[model samples]
Target: MQRPPLDPQLAITFFYYRDLPQAMRFYEEVLGLTLAIDQGWCKIYRICSGAHVGLVDETRGMNKWAADKPVQLCIRVSDVDGWFAYSQSKGLDGLSRLFENDQLGIRAFVFRDPEGYQIEIQSTTRTGA
Candidate 1:
């Protein structure tokens, strides 16, 4: 089968919340993501080039918050230890000890945001040939 031509642009992962302001504060202050766009009831944050996260107010969104959050946002970084320490200093919830995963080729740790969203900070463990 012939593969379709790839013309990738921007990507946005959205999370629905009960309190938009609180989620905005966490993403802005704690995560240090810049607000790229605002749609009144929804706020979009830039994670990096071509990547963003949109926080939507539950009342205005199609879905509501679930007790069992099925999504885990993973951010690949150059310094996993540094980010782990920083999050530890901030007293972030569910902070896990940094561990290397041979299978995944990464060293990572997990933490929860104020709204119970799980975020994973990781660095590549494999060395280039």
Candidate 2:
């Protein structure tokens, strides 16, 4: 008897500022992610490890959330300091100051995207495991 092939899937979803194209540009151009696909209203971008981040239009008067709250997205990078420094040099707003936590052992920092969502960048070598 032949066995069926296994399948794996993982994705990160995010809300956009009523414009999917604008968000795509930000993620692709600013964040340096590649645009895998964009189906007009919906867009999916490649981040890493076969993982994708999707941008959906939630501002179309849908009951996605009661009120507009800040969304938190964490992006893991090889060089946390480089990314953080480069983002700052681009005049990007770092909402929260970078700090090291002995608990998680991760050197991390927070910044806001164009749509006002908070994104945290951290090192993969950290002892956050």
Candidate 3:
């Protein structure tokens, strides 16, 4: 008999933070993401149906927090302009103006979270983006 393919239940992208509470507040109040799982030092917020972002305490997590953040978290949304306006109103750090990339067929904006982690919000301008 043929075996079934590997199937994962959920996907989570983890980011380490020096202050978990501050990060939690940003994710909850600013991003409006619901807490799917709470493991004390590690908090998992649901981005969508199956996608999640885990905020881990650097002191307790496997990886330690660093000053420079080379990684960026990008979320695809239906309304890029609306999100940009909301982000500006919140006075987010390192916020970038909404711009479009014709080659990539996307309208996007970027901003840093409370702990300097860059987050990009974008929407597809054309099909199959």
Candidate 4:
């Protein structure tokens, strides 16, 4: 089998929402993602390096949000505890206590955006062998 030619520059994960402004505020103000591009109906935010997330207005978007959410955005950070504390202070919704997973080797917690998209902030747990 011949491999297909692939040249990837960047990656973006898009989420469709009915309320664009509310979604924007949650991502911009609460989550602190910087806006890299704004296409009027759709806004692109830089998550890190070459990773981005696009927020699209439902009327202008190709798809709509389903009741069953099939996606969860996970962000690896240096400080899970700091993010958890900041989220609590900001009164974010659907916050989970920081917990460790031995198999995954991470300490993490989850919270929901205004549109009910789950965002997980995690840090790797280092073990001295």
Which candidate number maximizes TM-score? 3
By descending lDDT, how would the candidates be arranged? 3, 1, 4, 2
Per-candidate Cα lDDT values, in order, are 0.91, 0.71, 0.94, 0.90
lDDT of 2 by residue, 80-106 (tens): 888877778777765466678777767
Where in model 3 is the C-alpha error above 4 Å?
Answer: 1-4
1-129, model 3: which lDDT tens digit per residue? 998997988999999999899999999999999999999999999999899999999999999999999999999999898999999999999999899999999999999998889999999999876
lDDT (Cα) of model 3 = 0.94
Poorly placed runs, candidate 4 (over 4 Å): 1-3, 127-129
How do all the candidates rank in terms of TM-score, highest first? 3, 4, 1, 2
lDDT of 4 by residue, 15-71 (tens): 988899999999999889999999999999999998999999988889986666679
Worst 10 residues of 2 by lDDT: 60-69
TM-score of each: 0.91, 0.77, 0.94, 0.92
lDDT, candidate 4, at 25: 93
Off by over 4 Å in 1: 1-6
Error of 3 at 9 (Å): 1.0
- What is the lDDT for 9 in model 4? 79
